[model samples]
Target: MSWHSDDGSGTTADRTVEVWPDDDRLAEELGDALRDAELAERVAAAGRAALAAHRREAAERDDLALELFLLTLVHDSELAGGPVGVRDRSGSTSRTLVFEGDGVGVEVELQDGQVEGQLVPAQAGRVTVRRPDGDVAVVDTDEVGWFHLDARPHGPVRLVCESTRGTCVTEWLSW
Candidate 1:
């Protein structure tokens, strides 16, 4: 016998099958095929939904359109004015960056694989630390706008702060 089946593209294709009236196995095989087809359609629908969700997130990230500014790096000794000359050291030295905007200011200190930072005009908010490879670590700031992250992110990194002043995204930096 010949029948038509949907190929999932709003089009039908002819399928030829042989039916044996006395063979009970044919009936079982047909039932199994129908079940498998239904399962495949469900799986495809799920995959489509996941893809749509991912696209929406990407769009939101792009829509924020936060400005990126360079942060000036300063060493502890420089701030203290102990010595003006450069010195060669074996180990790493502590570094600090101060980012000042119109109404927002952020201070970050990096030492010993730990990040300690404070935000000016202190308000409660969440801070997100993002790596270049899309890895993110988040922390909530206290009422005083203090936050800490015990992670060492290699390569370029950036920060995103969501506070009463709205969202602020920092320029990529390297430690």
Candidate 2:
């Protein structure tokens, strides 16, 4: 049988089962399982909160040492045939950005909705690409410090390279 609460809460079942006629072992087990589930939920919530806080703190600190400096736009296929100061985006051309920091040089190429890049001074390490919407792609560099990503992101994006020398983060760029 089921009964509905007058306060519009919900319906409750008043059926009785004899699964544990000897004692309340079934109820105890259920209680333990529920407690474990609740604890897990709380831990997950705490972790989410901590991550949000960290993102906020990172957003506020713009002068981090690991933050890489924007050197210059070394090359742009769009401007290959045009004047140096001319701006054009009507053609299907890739863009290349060069960033230098901590004696390391990174070349990023944005082409056909894919990101491919290389690092100078050949070193083995990991490269993390982060988008403005918090989406991330992590890839390990080869022994020659080269990495590629099949996935592309919209809006502004940044890169953080971790190598034996140190960690360097690139400034956000939109292409």
The local distance difference test score of model 1 is 0.74
- Each candidate structure's TM-score, on Cα atoms with residue i matched to residue i, is 0.53, 0.52
Candidate 2 versus the native: TM-score?
A: 0.52
Q: What is the Cα-based lDDT of residue 129 in candidate 1?
A: 87
Q: How far is 18's C-alpha from truth in model 2 (Å)?
A: 50
TM-score of 1: 0.53
Model 1, stretches more than 4 Å misplaced?
Answer: 1-62, 66-92
Over 4 Å off in model 2, which ranges?
A: 1-92
Model 2 score (lDDT) = 0.73
Candidate 1: tens digits of C-alpha lDDT, residues 86-159: 34374556666676666786788777788888877788888888887785689999998899999868889888
Give the clashing pairs for model 2.
Answer: none
